[model samples]
Target: MVVERRSLIIDEREAASWIRDGMTIAIGGFINSSHPMAIVRQIIRRGVRDLTVIGPASGGLDLDLLIGAGCVRKLVTAYMGGEHYCPVAPMFRAAVERGELQVWECDEGMYYCALRAAAQRLPFTPWKAGIGTSFPDVNPEIKVFTDPIKGEPLLAVPAIRPDIALIYAAHADPYGNVQHIGTGFGDRALWRAADRTIVQVERIIPNEEVRKNPLATSLYGVDAIVRAPYGSHPFAAPGYYIEDAAHLREYVAAATAYAKHGDRGPFEAYLRKYVLEPETHADYLEVIGIKRLISLHEY
Candidate 1:
């Protein structure tokens, strides 16, 4: 039987409520590109706990935002930029070291493996990855075993069936259906790997936009849609417009500082003022006043 998909539309704050403690979530992004930061910040401000974030080459302003708020319990990703193994955003490191968080070394096939496992309703997948290397040292959760298919030794990773998936798209409709001209990756992988999915789009365009693409998401796949401006903060880099270098630097500094303080209060303050309390990301930026944040680092 083909399962039917449900649909919903919600605002940013309402969308964030889908996140909760100890739930794994697949986030959309590729390093410092095309991230869903405004939503990430709100997830921080709202104080969801013990989150495991899986992304492509993550670790930057968006990551700092989550770690500083103590929301991230573990991170399965390719890289953590700006600090090695964690100096700026050391919470993930600390958590893992202290046995509070499980650090999983991730890579390209990670997206495919996780989704496949979930779609097939299986347990940790067994496949050879990072063999004869330190992946085992970094992530003990990946059990080394023989492949049922290949008839050889392989690594098995528990299918990453996240409780929810947080993603962003170029545009969406009132019914929560989405279309991406470009910049959307792992949408199907994330959706299939999670229990529910929430999207924050730059605009709510007409539903007909999907007809043009024909391969765009169906109403059944989306759980909620949120209209967000500058949704891909810091990382999106805005085509020709300026990026938020100043804010990103400040966030990195704050995360490193939080590592020393061992508290989430400061990062929460940053998110509340710059992301959650405001009606929109622009509203937060306006109230914060870009000119003021630029001088933040000099301090």
Candidate 2:
């Protein structure tokens, strides 16, 4: 008998190619942290459209960029904003206001239940929190049901099954063992809910290093691994660097200008500068400049 081991390592472009139009895709990262921006940009560059995006609990540009680029047809998430910088994502608001996009309303608890239901291969998960609220009215999919065993009313949360999931992590091995320095949040659950998972990491460590701390390994059997140093650029990656506040402010300003005055120049210019023109991840880093990248860590 002969044994051979295969590596899951792939480049960013290839990872982006795994996605197709009309697929339900999930993005990992809570708010502006640990987002796989490199792969997200590549997806935009590839011109993949009509996607149903399942956003993280608190998503920012990772979801906004897709919506702004017309890649996403529907968004599913609890919130979309830049945290303290911006209350609501400008492009997302504009799209919703103009009837250009569809939103699947869900709160944090409902969102978790949906993903959990999918991960557990269950039809639906019943929750008591939304029974008395306006959740059923707002989201028609949520139904008030009576639990047979408990004989109590509960909201039935449906499963959110994504075709693919994109995640960013601190370290991973070629064998697809992933590790995150800080909190994984709902990311692991998102992984289990999706059919396939693609991860971009700051470093590709040795299998021995990964084996040293098996408990630290956040995920296993990831479908693809892309080595992307500072991969979560403009966002924070635990154990690596912090968010780029100046760049975020620049994005917010451009997006806000577009939303307020319908001025496409500033917003289009941003897309061209950071997204369209960057043929590769290295080019994006160059456009971000060495000084700016260094400052993220110092500040």
Candidate 3:
């Protein structure tokens, strides 16, 4: 029998307990966009090591935070970028440069492979992407071949079923129905393709409110819900404005300074503020007030 619809609202500690060592996790976010930074902070606090993190475009404060805290072991991303000069996801470049992190840089259709493979509960999804690009350089084994069901040139991608898919929403009902006004691509697919899904909502409301709109948040396939305030920031997605300019400017300067010279002190300082000191992303925001963040940077 199917379970009754209910949202599992949890504290950071309880929500973090859901994470285990060596689990393949997925984070939802874009360049300085709507990522589940709050939950990510707690995951970092737990210090779970040797985890594989996957996402579409994760170059943001969240990526650097996790990589700097040393929580990420492997990363699978379509791409990453920052609002400033260079990419924010230090994990990708650091891994390639330091030879410690394993990365799988997939192509566009690989997304099709990842989403479909997980959603279908299949071993893998075959496709025609990354045939002549750098993708094979990362995943040498994954390739295009004949489909077992049909004779055709097909590439197979291993099921990208994430142990946990952490996402953020502008609003959520008490029942865990989430509404995202903009850019919903792959949002629902990520959760439906994972073993468990956790949502951090900006506002909490009743099911009646959702029913008021035909485009309200959908209620199926949610496992957990968390109510948070201003969850987006240097991590806010497109629909939201940028969170902090001063910090972002500092980060860009730091990365560029490192590139120009051999000093990583400034970048490390930035890391200290967002990664080491704060227990949660919310705390980090408190450290840098919303108004100040705006004053310091631009969207």
Best lDDT among the predictions, by candidate number: 2
Off by over 4 Å in 1: 1-7, 57-59, 82-100, 148-151, 216-220, 237-242, 258-272, 275-282, 288-299
User: Any runs in candidate 3 off by more than 4 Å, and if so which?
Assistant: 1-7, 57-61, 147-152, 238-240, 255-264, 280-282, 293-299
TM-score of each: 0.78, 0.97, 0.85
State the lDDT of candidate 1 residue by residue for 1-299, as single tens digits.
89754446677777777777888887875555556666776676677887888765454546656665668777777666643223435555445555765567766665467567986799865656666766666677666776767778777766877777787776777666777645455566777777888877777776676657757553235778877766676555233123456666666655555566666566656666776677666676577576653433312
Summarize candidate 2's per-residue lDDT along 109-218 as a digit string, tens digits. 99989999999999888988877888899888889998999999989999989999999999999999999989977789889999999989999999999889899999
Using lDDT as the yardstick, the better of models 2 and 3 is: 2
Worst 10 residues of 2 by lDDT: 290-299
Give the per-residue lDDT digits (tens) of candidate 3, residues 1-299.
99786556776557777888899888775656678767787787788888888775444656655765678888777665564546444434655577767777676468657767888988887776555665655686476677778776666777778898888777777666778757755667677788888887767778788888847564345778877666665555444455555556676676555545657787677667766688765677788776765553333
Q: RMSD of candidate 1 to the true fold?
A: 5.5
Ranking by TM-score: 2, 3, 1
Judged by TM-score, which candidate is best?
2
Greater-lDDT candidate between 1 and 3: 3
2 or 3, which is superior by TM-score?
A: 2
Clashes in model 2: which pairs?
A: none
